[model samples]
Target: MKDETKYSQVWNLDKLYPDGSASTQFLDHISHIESKVFSLEEGLNFFNTPKEINHSSKVADLIDNIGCIRINLSQANSYITCLLAQNPQDQNAPTLKGKTSSISARFDAGLKKLQKILVKTDHHLWEDMLDTADLNPYKFILNEWRKKADMHLTDDEESLVSDLMVDGYHAWGQFYHSLIGSIKVNIQVDGERNELSVPQAINLRSHPNEEVRKESYYALEEIWEEKKEQFAKILNHIAGFRLQVYKKRKLENILEEPLMENRINEETLSAMWKVVSKNKQPFIKYLNRKANMYGHTKMKSYNFWAPIKNTNQKIKYEEAVNFILEHFSQFGTELENFSRQVFNNEWIEAEDRPNKSMAAFCASFPISGESRIFMTYGNRITNVLTLAHELGHAFHNHAMKSINGINRQYPMCIAETASTFSEMIILDASMEKAESGEEKLFLLDEKLKRSVMNFMNIHSRFLFEERFYEERKAGIVSSSRLNEIMHEAINEGYVGSFDNPSIHSWAWTPHYYITKSPFYNFPYTFGYIFSLCIYAKAKEKGKEFEKDYLALLRDSGSMSTEDLVMKHLGEDITSEAFWEKGIELCVRDVEEFITLTS
Candidate 1:
């Protein structure tokens, strides 16, 4: 069976290059870039005048050098990542991780010098130069960073903060990652006891045996409860430090900073959630139906993802690839051809095995014009959906490849649209071919689960973050206060459907109080709702919208969230009506699923 599966395959990096010598060559190129970029720093004041900037075309030349350096460093890191995916405990893994960070720190330091020059120099000068060259790769790159030029501290202070943050805020994030990844749990599988990590235990919840699912849930609850206090301390310290830093920067609101960085506004966020909160009943109805199907009167948190009766169907690797290829072909030629290239070129890793990375990601290489997808794919229907999801991301990168490299940078909000849109494509198509009542019910349930996360769960996170900042402005928010905010947020968001109060608070989620990305939670909701709207438009407009869709993807690097939506959808992001429409779409799905299930 393994031999018959295309996704039972692993990547061969030797096809990229033979060995350490290749990495050494790449490192040497970065070294050369490090020396050359310093000259740009020295010549910064000359960039004040367009006439004087003719000396090696200042920003353009700097961008080209930086692009080359990025490609080289990225390729080296990717080569190591591919190797590490196969054997996570590989000795080279830690070394490669450290080396990547060190190399990134050095690159960041040099880039900070360029940023200082931007802050001190006449901003109009660079923007004028960038505007002239539609082809000059730095167009989007400079525009994005230029927006933040006003927020930067003095040159010395900015540099010092950049250095301190590497060790201070960023290191704490790494610490959380290490702690969560290493924690072990005891879950009963088939009446046998075994220790597993959180990721592994969560995976067991999808197992066929009901007992296994129940055991996995209790095991996670036990482990998280035991470590709850320590996790609380980490959250407190991180959030406390972040608020202190924000205050020093003269930022009055925590939401203000994250909103600014997200290229969005508070009005838009509130509008989106208002719609989600109003339509919450449909989601609650769907949950109750799902719970009844599993023979529970009211749903327990543990049973949220339990399979519907007789709905377990295996979707083989080859079948999943073909399904994606066929549905994507409906989109257009360029997309279809790209999917084929990914499959034929062995660009996907989908084998399920022990000691592999816990999850999946599709990383695109701007220079190589290639994307590699990493996931341990099993022979399940959801696995196929996951494949389609990641490929959506890959297809997005493929679309952006022709854009100037600098403008290819996309915001996280727009980033998930294409991926979720692809999942919709697959799920929608899969429903048409579903053979039985059970299959239809299962598919509908999965769709509803997505709606829950996108609308209800993510909205709760935003609510929590909003209140956390409101309170934090007064003084340092204690761990207990943090938990209270979290509980209040979840209660308001969920509205008592989830009855278990014991499991509802501060469940060791690191996002609740991360220092670097203070409001990391809301972006998921933003990305989901925003992308769903775009996807709905695509379905309505059909082939007529392809050119505009491609244009949107291409310009994603250059435009703000508000500007992009206005240009593409004719809807103002700040308008509550626009978000209500997106929320309505999710409510419609829940209604449709109920009709089908009942």
Candidate 2:
């Protein structure tokens, strides 16, 4: 019963490909995308700077093909991604993934030409093409495309960079994928030893057994510690690639592309961090109290996810799903129904299996108007929250199902809006329904665990990446130096919370090696804090806010974070006060926890 692959519900990916990664249909799908990539590449040379977009339908046709190519490529890639995530050691999946990635690189080269033309297009003609070309729905993303043209090189140089990245920049990330997927964690529970996948090992972080939690943490640290040098090399090379590209683009700051990618400005980021820094003392206070509960002056880094004594901690899968859907129904019937349909239809892979991917996420398919969520559910309360969280992402995608292909893209910062908001709903509901002080404390601790993660833990990652990039410009950062930076960041964020922080954190964090998005740390904080503010608004407005929430999710595609806040909630995220308001919500819970403990 404990084996997740056997007892827990598994997602049916047959809708995606009947035979999974080995499906001939899947191969045919990839082939079609490859052909489309070639066709699109051939058309890239037929135009220069989008001539007469207002009069000629040629540019419009080109834009349409670009959209088609982009979506088709993504759909194929997403299918293979699903296959790999389930069993990272899948033999055929890697080859197929590489093929799709190669096709994607070629597709990106052609897309670069469109980006160049969009940059040089007349503003009036660009506006006319938005409507005349039937691309008005994508106005936000198209305008966004024009905004970043200052960073572009010549058309040929840009295309070449895209082509070269297939085997160079992205290849590093692919290598990391191969390395991490092969890792296995050995652990013993109740005199029985077992080998676990990285994700399964990670799930033990919140296990109720103290020794199991400690053993799992050390197992990960020991394994990743052995790979520190290799991980450091990957980190350095990944950073080097970005830095070289930045140098070639004539961009002065490393933060420029990350900030732009998240659709945020430095001021907004600065303001958010400022608010967190101001609020950290109380969070530290909570942490100190948590340490006292464990009879230690300082909580060890391995014990960060330690739980308190409680009667009800282990939540079964069936109970967890009912809890989430019930809580979601309180928010809106639509969210509840969507999640129910997804769960009933087997759209989530929650099997606790060996060689599974680490952590959880929802991947949406534009072609099918569906999303597949991946996770190894451990049946703890934390796992229930994860269930709610990923469904929120699926709901976000569902909310934007009617949106155009290009417009569906949003910055990752606001991408957490619905997910975090959904977590808040579940946390609040569980807190209110607690039957005893112990139950209340348990739920409160879970809520604050999220706070601890978003505030201290995520902050540490941000600091590490920021300092790592700064140091990387000078030379390749060493494994020892990487460890030092990681420790320093943790110490700075946690301050007096932990005497022994996890030093090998840089090695195990998949986000650090991810080539698609850098500085992925801050977005979690933004989403957490930003969603708190939205949670407040939802509670104040009650069920009516649900409509507004859906609207916000729908408009999330490519809207700047500040404008989204201003238009929906009328708050300026660039101001410290807005961030302060959000942080204050978490502070209230922390203060309550401290008082209850005292």
Candidate 3:
């Protein structure tokens, strides 16, 4: 019998375009944006005179035109990216990407000129510009631009930096991406040799058999070891370039830019970490119990994701879809309807295939008011939770549909809130429905593993990145030194839970290679903890909280992280008390796992 539900399905990209081929509509839109960007650049000349610049009609029209261009560019860029992600081997993808990059560079040049004009304008006139009725929708974006303008050089210098970044700074990131994608490692499983990509090898850490997991770990280590020197050079040049840029801007702290990017302050970050650090003992205890179950003295990096016992329960894709919808409905009808729209529209690509990307992401198109989720589903419980996670992101986008353009983009810190909250919903529901102690234990184990990873593993990555930047300021850090720093960070994060930590950790994390966002690791922890707090509130308030939760998601793009939390949850993010409460919920889970195992 051929079961349709058993097979993996490719997503329908026709929603973005009639076909993968570039159509006249796409080309015309790109041309229109290019012309608009050029016109905006010419409009910058009007800013020379306060009278002309302060004319409310002139400023309002300019803002509206810029917003239009931004929306069109975003839609086009999203389409190109979706096409590329669907098929990395698409020959035309590169050409289209280069063209898009050129368009983006030109737009950024015009934006720089605009920023200079706004920065040079008198304070009252800039306020008047913002107060213009037609510019009301772009108030948040314009205000943000004014703040960012303080950190930038002159328009010409900024343009030069943007131009150089194409081949200079960002090329290092591109090199790392290409290298990792092409690299493969050979491993023997069940007396047969198999070659695996970087992601496939990494996935083996969760294999049921210890030998296979350990072998995969060593195989990955060997591959990364061989490439460590090249990786070191890439890291050095990327960091050096950032430091040079920061020096030009006279920004002393490396963390400053990332903090601003994440829309958070130092106090909030410190408070969150302090609570996380204090709560590490409970996680270490959970790890100890897990290691004992695995018949080991202490848990190693390879054993972190090791399954406690294999479950016979295999959830088909359809079953998983229904499962997520049922739980989402329990939260709200709106959420349930959103999930239905995603599944019915075939907006998800869950096929397990060769040469496809190994990670999952939810990309939302603001102009179209739609989202596409990408993941590889293999009928595991984890895959079900991943679907729920990505759908959470989709729901967030759906909620923000009514929000103005450019204001729909949220920071990474709050970005994970909906996704993690979705995981919590499914995790709790699954735990409640488990028919046996064994099933319950497996669920608890999975839950604990996730918490530990988010709280500890992610913390280690943050620590390593922080120290790397500090040391890199002196000179180029060697491959061995990178390993040493990674080991130290791991040890610190693990809190002695592991007798020997993974040194090759630095080599595999693609976060380090991402030139756009440095210190990208800490935001995961922030989102996890923040979501936990929100989840606790949802449980407490029950049905009444659903509206507020939606409101939180809708406003995520418009407010600061702290303000968002305060408005929705009535909590101060900068206080240790709030973070400690979230940690306590995690500790309760750990305590429950200990009791079950005992």
Q: Alpha-carbon error at 35 in model 2, in Å?
A: 3.8
Off by over 4 Å in 2: 1-8, 51-57, 87-89, 122-136, 177-204, 207-227, 310-316, 351-358
Winning candidate number (lDDT)? 3
For candidate 3, lDDT tens digit of each residue in 1-598? 2226632357777767675746666677677878888788778766553454347566666766776777777777877777777777788767777777788887777776777666766887777766767566677767777788788987678878887898889999999888898998898777789998888888888888888888998888888889899999999999999998998898899889999888889999999999899889988998988888888879867888887878888778888888888887877778888888898888899987776766788887777788888898887888888989999998898998887665777899999999999889998888898888888888888888878878888999999999999999999999999999999999998887886677977878999889999898889989998999988888887767889999999888877888888988889999999999888888998999889888
Better of 1 and 3 by TM-score: 3
- Per-model TM against the reference: 0.90, 0.90, 0.95
Q: What is the lDDT of residue 411 in candidate 1?
A: 68
Query: Candidate 1, 480: how far from true, in Å?
Result: 3.5
Clashing pairs in 2: none
- In candidate 3, stretches whose alpha carbon ends up further than 4 angstroms from where it belongs are 1-9, 49-57, 127-140, 353-355
lDDT (tens digit, per residue) of candidate 2 on 320-410: 8888888788778788898888888888998777778775888888778889999888767667778888988899989988866666777
User: What are the RMSDs of all candidates, in order?
Assistant: 3.1, 3.2, 2.2
* True lDDT of residue 47, candidate 3: 54
Regions of candidate 1 where Cα sits further than 4 Å from its true position: 3-8, 20-56, 122-131, 134-143, 208-211, 473-476, 501-507, 513-516
Candidate lDDT (C-alpha), each: 0.71, 0.82, 0.83
